[model samples]
Target: MPVSVLLVEDDEVIRRSVALALERYGYGVTTAEDGLTGLELFREGRYDLLLLDVMLPGLDGIGLCRRIRETSTDPVLMMSARGDALDVVSGLEAGADDYVVKPVDTSVLVARIRSLLRRTTFRPDPAPDPPPDTAPDGPAPLVFGDLSIDTGGLEVFRAGRPVALAPTELRLLLEFAAHPGIVLERQTLLRNVWDYGWDGDSRVVDLCVQRLRKKIGAERIETVRGFGYKLRR
Candidate 1:
């Protein structure tokens, strides 16, 4: 089955062009001309991904993202006419998984959609979860003080309470937890956690980190002064 995508853009041209491109690439595309109608369709229908334009009539993309995030952790990709740092950061902060500068490249957009979907999809019956512990017994789940990460299960727990994490957040946590005490450079994190290459969109890492900190606690993931970040061992 083709992946379902809800594309909301204010511009008629961009909307039609993107919807056509996505359909050609074997995607099930649904489009909305404004944020109000977009949010309505989103609430009414089921979709695998959301492609939203930052500027819109009625509510904006950021607002829509926030509203959807309140109930679902589905993947959201935002686009802005101006590739400004503020716009990208704001989009991420509003719970968007990724952002694209407008006049989007169809190939790149497809690739981004693929990556986002892969990250967001959860596996069924995740390896039956090993005994929860940080024992160095070769391939045990990672434990940090009060936090527990079932690497095999791809689940996280804090103080025995389940920590709900988005796909990017979980992947980022896995990266840091896998190499406790080792500082990961921004570029390295971007390449590992995102489809971005080189120093591409380091703020994506930062925004993800910020959200992770809010869920897992700030004192756990330490910033390595101009270097990057490391999970406290």
Candidate 2:
């Protein structure tokens, strides 16, 4: 089936143009003119991804994103006319997986959408059963002081309880877990985790780290002054 998308924008021109572009790219697009209507559509239909404009009447993108996060972990991408630092930070905090600055470039927007969708489709093959009295086959969950990451299952546990993590957050944690105690540069993370090329913003990495810390414990991830971030050993 064609990848389904829910596009929510208050601007008539932007909404129509974006919907058309995605359709041409072979996506099944559903457009909403306001945040409230967008929320209603989301609750009623199943979509592979969500595209939201920051400034919307009734609910606004940040609020709408938060409401969606309360029950769903679907990939969300936001667009901001200002594209200021504050707007980006707010959207990420509200559980948006990625954002695009306004005057939207169709190519870049599609690339971001594709990247987010790739993560959603990724699934590590389940390991064959382990030999008796030995560890399970394939990739086992990485264990930290109080956290556990099951890369194959794509689930995280804290103190033996499942942690509710968005797809992006889980991917970030997996990256950190893969290289425990090693400081990961922002640019490297952007490339490896977000699929950004050379030119990418570091704020996305920083905000995602902050959100990961909140779920896994702030002390679990260390900020390395001018360097980068590292997972505690």
Best by lDDT: 2
lDDT of 2 by residue, 1-233 (tens): 99999999999998999999999999999999999999999999999999999999999999999999999999999999999988999999998999999987898889899999987676776578788999655585799988988787788899999999988888888888889999999998998889886668899999989989999999999999888999999
C-alpha TM-score for every candidate = 0.90, 0.94
What lDDT does candidate 1 reach at residue 164?
A: 91
Misplaced by over 4 Å in model 1 are: 122-140
Candidate 2 TM-score, true structure as reference: 0.94
* Candidate 1 lDDT by residue in tens digits, 111-151: 88888887677553434444767443434678999999987
The Cα local distance difference test for each model comes to: 0.88, 0.91
Model 2, which residues run further than 4 Å from truth? Answer: 125-138
lDDT of 2: 0.91
